[model samples]
Target: MQQTEFAFVLPQGYVDPEGNIHREGVMRLATAYDEITPMRDPRVQRNPGYLVIILLSRVITQLGSLEQVNTKMIEGLFSGDLLYLQDFYQRINQNGHSRLRVACPHCEGEFEVETVPVGE
Candidate 1:
């Protein structure tokens, strides 16, 4: 098997969304809070904007086009609906390739990541 270097690490303005990656202190605090309370809490690490968000963002950096990125991020995270995911996957294949499939180590959730070629 041939090894290929990663094409994209992060996209411009990606850090703009969350400002920066969550700090170690923030992660520790969130974990502690989740353990202590275990109630519906925003501080929990599994919150919408937590680790999974970061993981997905990194995945988007690897896409070959914007459609895959948009569909994977917008449709998957916000909608969590299968129809949208399938459509996105089909569209990516239609473009002559498929996106990288990233599965969460903690959860069974498998998602796609794409790296879009930047515009001129």
Candidate 2:
């Protein structure tokens, strides 16, 4: 079976009003509709950067113990977490995996490292 969901741990995480920090979450592979619908969002139209806000919310199916992930919740995330999610989204969607190819500058050797560890 194909894997459609990816698990992640935010660097700084999201803090709720009650003062709880959520670092672990799950983001699923984005579909064509997920990418297209957000482009039509008024917020995205107003600020091009907001496209990522909506896009991440749709793809992040779960965030810590949250029942549902939404745009407002996404907006509450720390800058580091947001940036991490953006890179994660690009990695999974574009590369079809969370591993990154790296080269050792000293030895000129190459290896792949998992950005988001699978199966926890």
Candidate 3:
């Protein structure tokens, strides 16, 4: 059997203003105990699971602790009516690399995209 992996997507902000991630969830957000904000962009959700893991790992590296990483992620996800992230990546069609797209969750503006591979 092919090894199936879980892919996670990062949004620039919350898509719905009234959307409750704890109940009718699009992304698995953090618990209510954290303080970080949620990103609402839909495109970030298009990224692969490994990319998500890698992204968070880099965050963990910066934080200098694994526990803090999860705490920060969840905090960002649970806080605010909506949140936003500037940088994000997605898997490119017919390719192993990711296509970088920049957009605001609130404005839905499109910007330049960059292609980068995972596990680099």
Best by lDDT: 2
> Arrange candidates by lDDT, highest first: which order?
2, 1, 3
| Candidate 3 vs. true structure, TM-score | 0.19
| TM-score to true structure, per model | 0.21, 0.88, 0.19
Per-residue accuracy of model 2 over 14-99 as CA lDDT, tens digit each: 89888988888989999999999988989989999999999998999988898889999999987877888998899999988788
Better of 2 and 3 by TM-score: 2
Ranking by TM-score: 2, 1, 3
lDDT of 1 at 105: 90
lDDT string for model 3 (1-120, tens) is: 421222333333223235423212122122222112222324335653333443433332222112233423433552331221112212321222234468978999987665332212
lDDT of 3: 0.31
- Candidate topping TM-score: 2
Prediction 1 global C-alpha lDDT: 0.34
Query: 60-118 in candidate 1: lDDT tens per residue?
Result: 33333232343234333323222333343334434434356779999979988773422
Question: Candidate 1: which pairs clash?
Answer: 62-114, 62-115, 63-114, 63-115, 63-116, 64-115
Model 2 spans > 4 angstroms off: 105-109, 116-120
